[model samples]
Target: MAANRIRVAKDKAELVKSLVASKDTTGPFQTYVEVMVFAAALGVKNKKRVPLGETTKREPSPIPQENFASLGYDLIIKLLGINETKDINILSSREEQDEDKRTQIFEEYANAGLEILQNELRGSVDYSERILLFLSLERDGYPSEKQEFDLRSFL
Candidate 1:
């Protein structure tokens, strides 16, 4: 089955060009609608594939772990891969909508590093203030670089 497959327009660059070059829509909905219409006119149904399951290697794979640690904000954001939005929303959800989720994310970040900021962080303060306060605490209190990074995990 794999041997019979004819690979056309390989890679994202070709895919994007193909999308742009073809615009055969009728209504106010422009690009995407036109694309769909073109496919429908040609009696082309969407291509289905066997599910990749737990081990599908998607394109544009993650950067090396060593590289991830160097990027700004990547350490915290990437490492915190997939948490529910409820837990990490001090800035967005100040209305007490989902403080528990935000708190849980905070605690998780704290745990990943050594700072363990759950106890020290004030509930009343906002995200920006917490960041500044955390930095100050890390610089003054923690004499080691590792400790500083740990506290910064939250910031």
Candidate 2:
């Protein structure tokens, strides 16, 4: 299973590299990878599962916990090129385990990808333009329900 996961990770890395190389930052492929990275990081930090339809006792924050269960942290780490043992250990350490801190660290990782995407799209386009394009594509074709949900929930 571990080996299979490694294979999958390698394949995903290749795909992401190609997407990055092609400079398709605002496209579905880049968005999917970014969302997966964020969702997975949330899963890693959130140990307990809050019951559905119940408001979490935790303070209000941006990233929704409800979506974390669908993505595994290990996979996210691989996709984001995070140094598994070093990065995960640092983030998960008891001394640094506060929810806010975890969220910050996760955001840093997630935002790095977003920054890359933005840089790729810079000069050529603006966020609103990309969003409009995405909206049009969503309207024209059957979008992946999970991707759409993640994109909406994250934003």
Candidate 3:
């Protein structure tokens, strides 16, 4: 069995946009983008910092949890390069698991997400909507073309 966790699902753009919307900041998208970039670097540095990148200049707020998750998933998928391989292993890094297992996990997660979107998150407010957006990574568990791109406008 695969591990189940609340992860992101939708396209990167949609998720980012949703996060921006949830944020109390009214500055601009660039601020959030910078913050997110620094946050990813912080994750790599293996330590926490109030400002992710100070040399860059203005010190923005710390990256939020969802931002980390988004960056992490992107790193995982890219590092794993599941696209080049026929499939992936949920435990590939640990025990050399196969792609089929990973693919199955992704499919199940995507399906579950679709169910949730239809039933629970179809018309939620901005805050609840952001939570649902982050949970979309699970819908995006495995790397592949987005199955929800066309729905972007609606989101």
Candidate 4:
């Protein structure tokens, strides 16, 4: 049986570790799952997908599905698959191939996102501030309602 753990591309392992808060590093997120989820979302937002290469090193380590599943990230996986195939039946099958497809989508997006983040964060010592600024810029770049009532608009 194949292992069911979610993977971080070997090349992006250090980036992942540096983004998560830990005793060794005071990153913005509290856990690896949080960082990866955010990365996956970023990838989805930017419409980028990058396949994993040389993942055998697994520096930050592969995450068990339960970690994200417990936090409801599995829905994001399923949603990505459905979006990619435009078939809701992708969600109904319990076959290993279907599961692998979802996992592949997630990993590719996360890998692409990590690459984007790495470039954006290069030479920056404060990831939290940089990330907030990056997010603000991204928000500003998007067209939205002129009278939108978002509370974040005030901040």
Which candidate would rank higher by lDDT, 1 or 2?
2
Q: Candidate 2 at 152: error in angstroms?
A: 51
lDDT of 1 by residue, 19-104 (tens): 33335312222232232223222221112112112221232221232332343322333223234343434334344334333333
Better-scoring candidate (TM-score), 1 or 4:
4
Number of the top-ranking candidate, with lDDT as the measure: 4
lDDT of 2 by residue, 68-144 (tens): 43444443433333343345444443553433344443444444443343344455444546545644764697566
Lowest-lDDT window of 10 residues in candidate 4? Answer: 1-10
For candidate 3, give the lDDT of residue 149: 58
- lDDT by residue (tens digit), candidate 4, 30-54: 8888888899899999999998887
The lDDT of model 4 is: 0.84
All candidates: CA RMSD (Å)? 23.8, 17.1, 16.2, 6.0
Better of 3 and 4 by lDDT: 4
In model 4, the Cα lDDT at residue 19 comes to 93
Q: Candidate 3 on 24-143: residue-level lDDT in tens? A: 533223435432442233233322222211111122232233443555553432233353344444446455344334333333333333333334333555535444464476466645
Which pairs clash (backbone N, Cα, C closer than 3 Å) in model 3? 7-137, 7-138, 8-136, 8-137, 8-138, 9-136, 9-137, 87-99, 88-98, 88-99
Which number leads on TM-score?
4
Off by over 4 Å in 4: 1-3, 142-155
In model 1, the runs with Cα more than 4 Å from the true position are 1-115, 142-155
TM-scores, all models, native as reference: 0.20, 0.32, 0.25, 0.86
